[model samples]
Target: MTSPQLENHLPFLRKTGGAWELIVDNKPYLILGAELHNSSMSSARHMESVWGKLRAMNINTVLGNVTWEDIERDEGVFDFTELDRVLVAARSSGLRMILLWFGSFKNGSSSYVPGWVKTNTRRFPRAQIRDEHGSLTLSDSISIFHSECVMADIKAFTELQRHLANFDRQRTVLMVQVQNEVGLLGDSRDRSLQAKKQFNSAVPNDLVRFLSSQFNNLQEDAKEKLGRFQDTLSLCHPSDQRSWEDWFGSSVYTDELFMAYHYATYVESIAAAGKRAYDIPLFTNAWLPKPAVGGGLGNLIAAGGALPGSYPSGGPISNVIDIWHWLAPSLDFVAPDIYDADYTATCDTYKRGGRPLFIPEQRRDAHGARRLWEAIGSHLALGACPFGVDSLEPESFAYTAQYKLLGSLETLILRSRQDSKRTFGFYFDEFEGQQADKGPPIGVSFKEFDLLISRAFVFGRPSPGCGMIIEIHVGRYLIIGDGFKVEFKSRSATSTFTGILRAEEKSVQNTVTGALRTERVLNGDETRSGKWVNMPSENPDYGDGFIPLLTPAGTRIVEAQVYSIDE
Candidate 1:
């Protein structure tokens, strides 16, 4: 038999990449994504229009939710005809899918469950909370204890995965987000008799083991205590507090701890099922805060019950939910579903995990648009996906995307820029913005930085003849613009400083826009001058520049790169 044909695959987003950069065809691939509902248009023809919009925007991944309400409206019965049409349309449009198996919980609600389960008060149970009238209400509509954990939901979802494996396995649809935002949303950890019994049982060996390894030589009281506190490891805090009270203070600690545990269990289980059927990489997306706390947004109160409420004027837990590092060890990668502004801080928080980050969902704001570029060259982000790529207005879509993300990603597409490229990592440098001398030269020693906004203003006003001074280490960092100069010392070649070997200058530009030229100064007069670079490049067209003269204590950059300066 002939070998099976594979379409453009996003193998990087799958299970094997783990915490590192996602590699596709032996290279790390970045995914610019947007999440879409199962049927925004409720028909295949509409999907074609949506896909065209996504392609024009250059979005690479689509997070599509496959709902239980549509698949299994009746128990022991299933329907996938509509979902099949959506997947086929998505594949034809050349966009990959991070399929959300909307099996049980979506933002802590059972609204999507089958009618039989939702209406029945007996077989499928509900979470209980003390209502204002001294009666109990459902903790959340979707519960593993009540609605979702059923074999009914699992079988149908598993079947959905099987269908995708058979049909679109080798196409633009590559990975699956087993579930959407899996977490416990209650006034407290479930207190119902059924939930309490399961909660009281000796904590699972796996978690106990992981916890034991994390805090070795600590008291057993600590282990037992964390279990009692349940949600945020309250055992580490004051002894007098109740688990629910943990909700009121430093909400991140509790929200994140609870989310990480709950989400991990759900993802691992769902991933196991999907892997058994199709062995693809699976992930989950966290609905994050605009100025969120590190753990998770703590505002989801559904039908007067607790759920993941990080959206819509959420309460206390905003700041604490932003900590990506605290939850790093648990999931494949934690994605921030961002909405609102200040894109820089949001992306920065995610990267703190030290794992290669993927912006699975982002705000519709223009600042968020520019940030995609900033993230690519500045932080070495693996992928960036805008939210709702399918629904974006037609007018400025291409203009925003083609330059916003596609421009920077060009380095990874070509055979030459592939291996030579390096992530800029953390830095202390400066540059010019959008005005005359508006762009300025910036420099940073391992200890300090050189910032010269513009020499243009000191003598005259900036005008039509423009210039730029940017300092960066990614996607061909060019310190000066077309008619400028720049110079800096080479790091190290063979475990020692490679002294200044005369600076050479070369202006390189995209084959298309020779007007947008770049000048590189590998080495120059600034080397070993006590300060790496004191005077900015005197070259008129090159703009400003930066030179780093690392101190003796700093580890020499392991390789000696050739030095140059040319026009």
Candidate 2:
């Protein structure tokens, strides 16, 4: 299928059926991505050491940062020397790039802004927060209320985009992140004199109209939060101006909504300007809020806090995501930096409004690495990225093997986007002692049959596994990955029994050509005597006995067809 024509052949996001695909060079592209450390791309020398390792890890895309302070050390003067060098290296290494623009804000602080913006607070203006002593103090983050800060950011970002458009015509840069986890750090809402005055004034007519019109389409959590103000919202007119407290009620959440609107608009100005210079997919990442855990505030604080300021107030958390969506139309989507949050739940939440799901930052451990299956297979994510990969050795990288497998199945995965219901992806993680019961078998219903998928059977203790099942045809499946088994059941009412008819261990003949060759035709032990099809783990334990019912993993691909006996 051909992608829609876009301006300048720039990479864009398109929807196919109920799923989203990232189109590059007139074709659907799957990103096997890894994000570098924040400072890794600041110097070409530092990135030179990292590019070779990323290629070895099977990473197709590199998410790196372009700091305002580094690129524009002096006001109105820009330097793209380091950024250009890094781009050249990445292209030579056969890697795509997603540049994160660290302007005005980085993790709720203005530390990454150029010295001119940082030192001249009177000109750019810093946000103010109430201290513990109830005194208003300056925060490190710039005030979004001031146009000076956003205008400076827009100038720097537009220049960056213009440079990329001219210097790199190959389109090596696939996308750009507008900022890094933006929001206020010390307080729920900015308490500057101007901010106070604006808060007391009537709310924006545009925002009031959005809430009144799109109320039904808002996320469930957002709806719940706004439920109390339903009466006021219903009775309000589009031109009616009311104080923040009077419109949204008296609560800290109202403060969050107020800040979310400003932050979204602040980002919109930069993103919209950058798009005008050179249109490419642009998005921002959010530092998600952590629900209270272990019954203590310490865990909350460590997990980025339960309240707004505790965790970058006014950022695009789920509760305030609708506000960002309404206000930040220039941003392609709002992505989540998932750590210490429910990965699957976060994916579902961000999938609101039919927006694409692309994890910009996540954990680098095995536990975090395994969840990408659900993100891609079930949720139809454009990509999943693990942060801080430059520091890890290629062999030690948890996603190395996963990326290799995914790279091989990239064609099939992308094709499944058109009919995602015929595909499913799942994973089972290693459990603590006696906790294996929690990892129950997954059941999914297809057009013709039902599938019960579980950890690949072993005579000894079972090992953790992850894989995806795609229905190549009715009653037939192509299974990929290690440590999984499938039991098929017929949906027909008259069917008495269902069993595997044929199971073949297969290897990829050519990934580009999408050709497969069967290595072995298995019957008795491998298929559990026709009861199921087993794709054994990398090293299946045999309980130290003579019987060899289980075998070690091979190519980790299997094709199985199931049949039913109708009574």
Candidate 3:
């Protein structure tokens, strides 16, 4: 089949060695994005009011939902009125978009399906899950086993893509998420008659062959989870067949694996159909597992249930991520909708085996804002989108300052990402008097210098700070953000000491060119007389004994170079 022709430039992903870049207009583009509330994009007037706020906050891209129910209220009939309005408004605001297709399964519920599909339960069966009692009850989740359900979703999504290609010839819509947090809810696996019948039947020969071939390449954790399946595959003769329970044992993990296979296959079909229609980059997002207390998996917090039904079963979490990757070929990547999870660990897990990392959703708070530096700088992530951006005013949003700094330095940051080792990002969280000694100081070595970064020194208490250090050239580095300090030492065996040669604060002189113009030369107090370079937070606590009541936050970008000396 031939792909649809895109008239103007289309956004695509490119891998440069270890790092991946999002290319827009044939240039490396950093997506400093903000996701609107789920229901906000339905009204064009409401969207018009918030576009200015999003622009003021320095958001280059916006992530919003485009539900199937809204677009296809009647069977075979599709409406693009709201979608067109959103695309036009985003273009007017000079912003790009990633539309989340809230179809088939939305957060483990089929509530977003069209009324016709929802009303006809007999034609399109719902997943059955165990209620509080032992008896089974129908859940709101649509059954993946049914052909009618898959076909309906594929039709709606294909039409959406066709319409996008026609209306958005400018390529304002950069990417599309096939479904929203798709998984089996309220049960580890669907308990309906159709699901049970399939579960008891022989495991699909395609999946069995895939598992047998890719066993060695799968992640260690994945191997351990599917060890039983491997054994079953090895023992079973060509004439013999094994069911899901027979292969993986009757555990919750097995149930999760079964659901993941179906979900991935279903999403793959929809994504493949959409690609045939328009061929824009397509992906899906997962509701990640919350932090586990220890290896034993009991003291997990937030919705941190390790069992299949505890969280959304069959979502593309780390445990089942490899399965989705093997099955969902059409999906460009899988993203995490991070809220209360451990940010660094989650990002690291998602980018396993050279996968592209793009955090589509995260908490919209100061804590979340501080973590973006690590995600983008250290992980080489394409972008980070904090959720519910439209609800907050530009002045109140925690990411406003950080986004502005990143927006201005987009070019420089993209350049630095190529050499992953030379660049390091860090964040110093607020010291709440008790948990002061949590994270250890970060130490890095480059050339003959040892760089030590820790929380900026404060008299009374330390406030939150976040930033990245990019070594533009040998011994020369560009540092951006607030609330951190860099201390340098000599790594040379001969040199006695290493000291900063020059540290200058920089500002963007030309926004279009991303040219950095030095605003002030730092030496005496700012550098503490070559001791360290401090980019203090917006409000630093200098203590009551000091003359100036409170030192305002020093959220400035700086450049520094160092030289070693032997006495």
Instruction: Report, for all candidates in order, the number of backbone clashes.
Output: 43, 0, 2
My TM-score estimates for the predictions, one after another, are 0.63, 0.96, 0.94
Residue-level lDDT tens digits of model 3 in 396-515: 999998899898888888877655547777787765657746556789877667889877767767777788888877778788888778899888788887888999888888766778
- lDDT-superior candidate, 1 or 3: 3
For candidate 2, lDDT tens digit of each residue in 341-369?
Answer: 98878998998768999999988888778
Over 4 Å off in model 2, which ranges? 1-7, 234-238, 293-302, 419-421, 544-546
Worst 10 residues of 3 by lDDT: 293-302
- The TM-score ranking, best first, is 2, 3, 1
Assess each prediction's global lDDT (C-alpha) against the native.
Answer: 0.46, 0.86, 0.84
List clashing residue pairs in candidate 2.
none
**Tens-digit per-residue lDDT, 8-74, candidate 1:** 3435442222234554544445566666644563466667667777666666667777787787887
What's the distance in Å from true for residue 83, model 3?
Answer: 1.3
